[model samples]
Target chain A: MTIEGQGAVPGLTARIFAGHAGPIAVVVLAIVVIWYAGAVYMNAPRQMDVFKRANADWGAVDLIEGTWAQDRPILPAPHQILAELKKTIIDQKVTSKRSLVFHTWVTLSSTLLGFATGAVLGIVLAVGIVHVGTLEKSLMPWIISSQTIPILAIAPMVVVVLGAIGLKGLVPKALISTYLCFFPVTIGMVKGLRSPDPLQMDLMSTYSASPWQTFWKLRWPASLPFLFTSLKVAVAISLVGAIVGELPTGAQGGLGARLLAGSYYGQTIQIWSALFTAAALAAAMVVLVGVVERVVVRAMGGRP
Target chain B: MTPSPVQSGPAGSDGDSVVRAHGLTLSFQTADGPVHALSDIDLEIGRGEFVSLIGPSGCGKTTLLRAIADLEQPTGGNLSVNGVPAHEARLARGYGYVFQAPALYPWRTIERNVTLPLEIMGMAAGARREKARDYLELVNLSGFEKKFPWQLSGGMQQRASIARALCFDPDLLLMDEPFGALDEIVRDHLNEQLLQLWAKTQKTVVFVTHSIPEAVFLSTKIVVMSPRPGRIIDVIEADFPRERSLDIRETPEFLEVAHRVREGLRAGHSYDD
Candidate 1:
């Protein structure tokens, strides 16, 4: 069928334009403008200081020759970070042992493992809570309370405890991610399991269907939207947990370690680059969940 | 228990009474106390008969149908269908039951909704498809099979529900105010369609409705029920011809039966009060 004849294409296109295009354009424009303005303002003083320092120290290579490139103690310019990103990704062997890519891969692995573990545990717990009223009434409040304890404060203890037992590398990081990722999944699943309408439940009862059948046919399908929503939240939290886990372990790899080293040595450009990488990773994880949601719901005969 | 009044009719050659209830009493445990929904109710419906249980809102007509459908248990007395207990009859010989509202599942397509009972009965896939198609055509919803329930209008949904009920070709059909929510024009059209359906299927139908003309137009027998502690007050045998039309409402014979049903209703209320 022709796209217009299908009765959905125009509306879909309009929605994309209205909801996404405008905000994205505006945000992109604002960020570019702000970055350039900040670059000019910050670089003026830094360039003068660099010129002075280079003239005193070595020669004009630091002052008049590539002097603008040479001198920030912290808060490096956008161009500097971009140059570093290109050098690390292309010129330098980033995928090798010494590169940032290897560390990023390590962090990504722990984050994914932790997220999967947490999501499965959370979903199981949610199913149990939904089926058992006592668990729902008693355990829900405690789960909520568990989130209040800061991961930053707990990370050191976790690292120490695991280290004492000679458990290191990815386990502690994955556990932290699991801890952060599970809460949203539990809450979302509980809401989803309870989402079936009274009439739908009554229909199942009229069929003399067992509770298990009802759950399989009705409750599970109804929970899909909520499950995906929780997945998005859990993925972001999983990244946070992985980052926190890296903080106390004195780990030499991963974005968290890069962030720590950059801060300690006053390499602001490295820190910002790592932060951006983490943000991109989290975005990628959420996008992956969105893709899975689309595939699943479509398989279940829903119009995604 | 008091015996039901004699049916006073020549026995049909087939000798199949589709439904028979003896001294049926139904009570629900409400917060206040035990509420007698139905009491000492005795009814018998013959094969190919169309009967309407006409009563006020709370007169337990729907409750009686539910009991007959094995969806509810009678507090006392025996209810049988086709020579067996209602529950057993329901399991062995399935009965089509249409609730007051169109209880079509929202998630299912109209075709799937019609085939639900067939699926439940474990009918073969090919036969189920053919039967669903036939019933959708019966309800004049031939082109809308693939549409979801929410996409249809209320009248269309009700039609789909009726189609679903008839999909299994059950000998007995119990409808609870099937068209009470429709507009007058739609109700008249549906009544004609329903009579046509009855003519074709020749199934025993026990329908619950409050409309006097509806009961008079559709039913071979009108069981007028009373409220409070609900009980049958009158049973009117409609003398209207078998092949009825919407124009039957203008006839004197139809008017006489309508008058009788109304009087039965009034007398039922007065007797209760």
Candidate 2:
């Protein structure tokens, strides 16, 4: 018997969309609407000045259109940024320097490298902090103080110093990302590694398990959830680091370079497009980490 | 309350003593001041005997157990396990201690949980698996090897934990209220199974519980204790048969022993003022 035509029964597809996609769609729509309004408000004076200079009369509709369609508006409209994204990311060849795809790849490489190095560094530091009392006392203060020195202020110095030593290109940029990302990872991991309850620790002691064995069997696994959590934050911030790294160096490639070029040219659409692309990239990386977390949690017999 | 007379080592036909404590005391150096957890505890547990420490909260029954397990450092007194110092016995893996909570690692499956101690002790993979299998079967958890700790009921999880404790084949089992969190029905069932386990393995069991029925049901000797500096007030002997069942609880002999334990517990509380 078909259960399709019951009274007041919403279709499954409709129900699914209502529960999951509906709210997100509304939020995005609201954001786009607000963005469009902000664009017109910011760009109108420039359009008005252009019209007055050209001795051309313009109605409200013309003025609105002018603001939205400006060659170099103060704040580009959503459609303009989307058009620029399509031109650079989809229309242009990926190998082309003008292509956002190429730029994204350049930035992504450094981001990944920095994230890997930073994660390893963070884990090592955390382990040392947990196991060695002196390291905890000595290294922790310095580590905290290191983060207090603004990354932006340090980024240029790091680039210049590393460049002087002939360590240029990806290494310098990745190092900046490493600097920005490692703090969260270190803090999260220290907490995670120590997350095991007293009972668990007591159990290990009872088994006469070596400290090494205890670390591998109990602390490592216990720290996994925390590690993944820190990784998501680390990955996202590392992208920020990569972008900032590109800024001081005036890099020839990368999303940061695209943003730099766009800012130099006063190409608002290009800048906004680069920003959206960076945001999408960060989201993708976090999602990738979350996927791995799910797989690990499931494998360890937890509900993913 | 006066300290109970120290039970001489090698009680009855149980042979040599497994755990012997003389004036065992633990004081936690708290912010307020030093807090006595256990004071002047003296006891001797024989091989292959089930001994239960029955006391109220803050009575140092668990502290005493922790002392035996070497989980807590005794500030004053001499304690030995298997003729060596408690710490040394722990290093030798001479005993397995079970906490009030199952404390099973959420990440490990039932069988894997059982094999944890073996893995830590560097037992080979094949051997660990075999021993895990045997212990799981012994605890009646054979088919649920792949199931995680969270998948099982509270009683089952506790049983799996017991299997984990037993897998390493430690001659002495130190359990601190293993079934305290469980329902009365589950507790009774587990108490029976524990008795069967103790009988089969012939291992010395030091159990901690607040329930008198549980203590009388399981222990061949019950150490009734008091709080406020935490000391034992009385030690009562339970001479029930080794092969006894749950039906033994209804027997006149079991009730008499249980009544004596209740009196000892009340008498321990009388000096609270």
The number of the candidate with the highest lDDT is 2
Chain A alone, TM-score for each of the models? 0.85, 0.95
Give candidate 2's whole-model lDDT.
0.91
Query: How high is each candidate's TM-score?
Result: 0.78, 0.95
User: Per-residue lDDT for B19-70 in model 1, tens only?
Assistant: 8888999999989999999999888787878888999888999889888878
- The global C-alpha lDDT for each of the candidates, from Candidate 1 onward, is 0.81, 0.91
lDDT tens digits, residue span A158-254, model 2: 9999999999889999999999899999999999999999999999999999999999999999999999999999999999999999999899999
lDDT of 1: 0.81
lDDT of 2 by residue, B128-225 (tens): 99998899989899899999988899999999989989898999999999999999998888889999998899889999999999999998888999
DockQ of each: 0.19, 0.83
Scored against the true structure, residue B53 in model 1 reaches a CA lDDT of 93
Runs in model 1 deviating more than 4 A are A1-23, A35-81, A90-94, A97-100, A132-135, A138-142, A153-167, A210-212, A295-304, B1-42, B70-93, B121-124, B143-145, B150-153, B226-231, B264-273
lDDT score at residue A214, model 2, on the 0-100 scale: 93
Chain B TM per candidate, please? 0.93, 0.95
